[model samples]
Target: MSFNNANGGRQLTDLLIIGAGPYGISLAAHAKAHCLTYTLLGYPMHFWKHQMPQNMFIRTHPDSVYLSDPHESFTLLRFAAESGIDLPVPLPRPLFVDYATWFAARTGVRFTPEHVLQLSRTADGYEAVTEGGGVYTARHAVIATGLQHYSYIPDTYDGLPPGLVSHTFALTDFRPFAGKQVAVIGSGQSAWEAAALLHMAGSDAELIYRRDAANYREGQSGSELIQLGETFFDLPLEQKREKQVQPPGSAAAFLRPYVEGKIRETGNAVVQKAEAVDGGKLRLELSNGETRLFDHLVSASGYRIDIGRVPFLEQRLLELLEREDDGNGRYPKLDAHFMSSLPGLYIAGPLASYSHGPAFRFIAGVRKACRSIIPRIVRSMAHARSGSS
Candidate 1:
């Protein structure tokens, strides 16, 4: 619950983890099992609690939505059974949040409920300053921050006034837009679902996307991509790329029927650009050469994993970190062990997807990430201690 330095100075640990979302909690479970001294900082499942809509359902199947526990006893399904909760496939968000909390408690991964304000390198390892003036020092730091901060608001609407436009990730509810003319941009699941929620809330909702139609995962029984088992990560880079051919943000097959029938009943219409208009409204320039206005606009365009947007990293340390082949801040260039160019610093979760491939993007991927990286980290720490002694 708390890891404060009683002496009002830096509390030293072997590992410091930021963000207690699914990835952070999974990594904390692994660190606990390894007997590594670590301090995890962040509210558990903060994004799910505050950002996602209250009635949302996860796209991942029940079987895949689990945090990695070395003992393998605690799982979403198991938690549901033990708690006498009936679980429907494509689990509900509330149930998953409860399951995550149960798993964190069951795994004994204590998290310090604080935000990391800044992270900088130190002579020994790294230093993290928290919101409450608490400083933590560790031999290494692992960033498990999820997609919350990376929400993508396209440049097309960048100059718009703040109240006129926003990302779907920023809104937890759509009730405020009731009776208002709202425009939901993008053809992805988020866009479709947001439109549906807006409609349910009594808003006049319209959808816009560049694509001719909304893309959804096809329901194919025993598909190779879905059946990717424990050894999937060991495949060649080309093989991984083959599986990642599916573009991001496409709706899951399980929700396709509902979304298509209820939300995007009509196919997508092209939107060339969007501009802010008077009275806190937005003007959409359609590819069909017509302009329309809406009282509010929500971009469900998805997130861009630009590392530069991460505000906590010190400038000097940020410059030292390597970037992906594109040499863009969109992704970090990580080594085989998921360590960045800077030694003893690791990147996990969706951020690791660029290097580790598609599997790193969701809760399903956390097990593989932890299984692969934890042992390496333990070994490196051991070696460091021996060398110093």
Candidate 2:
């Protein structure tokens, strides 16, 4: 399938995946194995290379980091053995990105390397507008954009100007904040990590959280067998709810030694709220009512899952899909096969986690998602042909 010139001037496919992240790539690989025509768009590992800090590491264990394939030949362990690289537990970011690129090449999964500017529903299926002035139509579409669009800044800092406030997701480097007084909000991994990075980069950084004190994840006693089903990825919806006890922003994984030491040395800080004051600085009201000014504030407050944040999703298409909100935010209702209210459209990755369970938020979730969705896609294709005839 030549995606570039498939139908002359424009491309078309049986399945259109809008992201090339872990989930997106995995889905495309499955579609190919099923002998289904599919087209993948977007830069592979774009966030891992650009949005994340250079020195950052994935919280997931090396054994757990993977994209699902039919033969299972591209496992991290297999990749390490083939490449002769020592794969550690907390895998380095650069190494993982390399593995992803290598996997895509080995699988022979062709990608368009274009951004999907907008998406809308069509009579037969859907239409996607690309940044390169290309139009693609597909009988089915899956959204795998990941958490890039879901980064949330608190409502308290709503009135603050852009430069004075930002989120950790937007910070690729800390050198720009050198010699400036920066206040980091939240006590989770991103918050503490950002504070440490800022301080190490020559900024006077401090972490402030609503909790009494920071809580670090306790170390495990011993290594356990790494199994997909046991990892909570294959659990039923009710069981998944029981297992996921931590709050949304809480990081169950511990920080690296160097970053932890830096945060501890800075001492504990708590905040009640923040307000904009003179000189374009933020005046933070502490729990004890003491106020302080800072050059900038970074909200590591974490992501709020809202379906509407996806800018490219046309409003009409969005409204047509059935959604359920649990007071926090709205998420599309998905079936057992991860198909949305729209018969042919599917939702994967973090966005579908709410309906399917927390397992959809991790790489472990990709296996089940692909296994379930691909077979259903084949069935749908067969049904469509039979109906048209």
Candidate 3:
């Protein structure tokens, strides 16, 4: 049957996967190619919607970042090979966006491109509310927002002028800061890499964090399968409280060699350990009470799992979905199939690992997550068909 026949004028669908990042885009592309009658909605790469400078690169490796299609016709490696770019596979942000756009065009993956305002489940299916004033229905949903819905802004900096300070997530470009002085708060890969990029662009940059020194991720000597689950993904909620371990995503992923290269081994960038001082001027009072002047700042603080911020997450249903990040935060609890305890709902990406173990965060885990989820989705569709017949 033609896809339009299924779409028709009605908003009904077999499955509705939210947030069209790599994970969502991959899932949607696969479901449609399999003729599963699914509707994949949400903005396509909304994270890339903002303006970022052309000089940045992705932290992850290249060959692994991929879609779920079985054809294997297009891969990051192939894209790079065809472009003659010959960069490492993790892919730059812009190239990844171009890949997604190409996939959407080739596979007919659809997106609303507007904010999903609300989600609710009725007896028959789920209702998704969008800012464009449209309501769409589907029997199931897989959330693959891939960090677009969350930001790590600090509360103390809330009242500060937007120009004086901003989250690393908010940074769009570093070009204007050429020859300008800048202080970056946070020691994770983000803070480190942002500092490196700024310096390369000719900005005088300083790195600051609460810790005395940077704890770069220890490079895995072997495949991620050998790494600690805690290093790859957080332990389950019950498991964390029992061991009293620090929650996942609380610290940056273990630093790899490639990532460490971005740090200033030279004196061009300064690393200071301190909590930032509050002031009206652009000068920063260091933890040691030393003050330094800066033209701009970037806070690579951290993120919270507040359901209130996720535009597409259902309020009452989210209350029903148990927190799995060892109860330290409100993350969804999923079974081995990546199905949320909510039933008919599935989760992928970093969120799943806190419950299923460390595989949720890796490129390897993304492949594994889909391997388990897709079969179950197909089985679910088959069962529904038999029941209707």
User: How does candidate 1 fare on TM-score?
Assistant: 0.91
Model 2 ranges off by over 4 Å:
1-8, 218-256, 264-270, 387-389
Q: How do the predictions measure up, each by TM-score?
A: 0.91, 0.89, 0.77
Q: Give lDDT tens digits, candidate 3, residues 310-333.
A: 666777877787766554565677
For candidate 2, give the lDDT of residue 352: 79
Candidate with better TM-score, 2 vs 3: 2
Q: Pick the candidate with the highest TM-score.
A: 1
* Worst 10 contiguous positions by lDDT, candidate 2: 220-229
Among these predictions, the greatest lDDT belongs to 1
Q: Residues 1-389, candidate 1, lDDT per residue (tens digit)? A: 23434233676788989889988888889998999888888877898898888787777667667788777778887998899988886678898889989998888888888888899999989998888877889988999898877888777787778888879986877888999988888777788778878888988887777676767775333223333634554679788667656564566666555555555333446557887766777888887676788899888878877788887888898889889874456788887778998888998888887777666666656776777678888999889779999
RMSD of each: 2.7, 3.3, 5.4
**Candidates ranked, most accurate by TM-score first:** 1, 2, 3
lDDT of 1 at 269: 61
Score each candidate by Cα lDDT.
0.78, 0.77, 0.62
TM-score (C-alpha) between model 2 and the true structure = 0.89
Candidate that beats the other on TM-score, 1 or 2, i.e. the better one? 1
Question: Cα deviation in Å at residue 51, candidate 2?
Answer: 1.0
* Tens-digit lDDT track of model 2 for 1-389: 12343232444579889898888888888999899987787887788888988786677677667888888888878888999989875677899888888888777777877888898988868888888877888889998888889898878788777888989995988999999989888877788678878878988887777666566764332123123323454577577667544463444355646455465322245556777788778888876666778999988977777788898999998889888555554788777788889878998887877676666666667877888888999998898799999
Q: In candidate 3, list every pair of residues with a backbone clash.
A: 61-90, 62-89, 62-90, 216-255, 217-254, 217-255, 218-255, 237-326
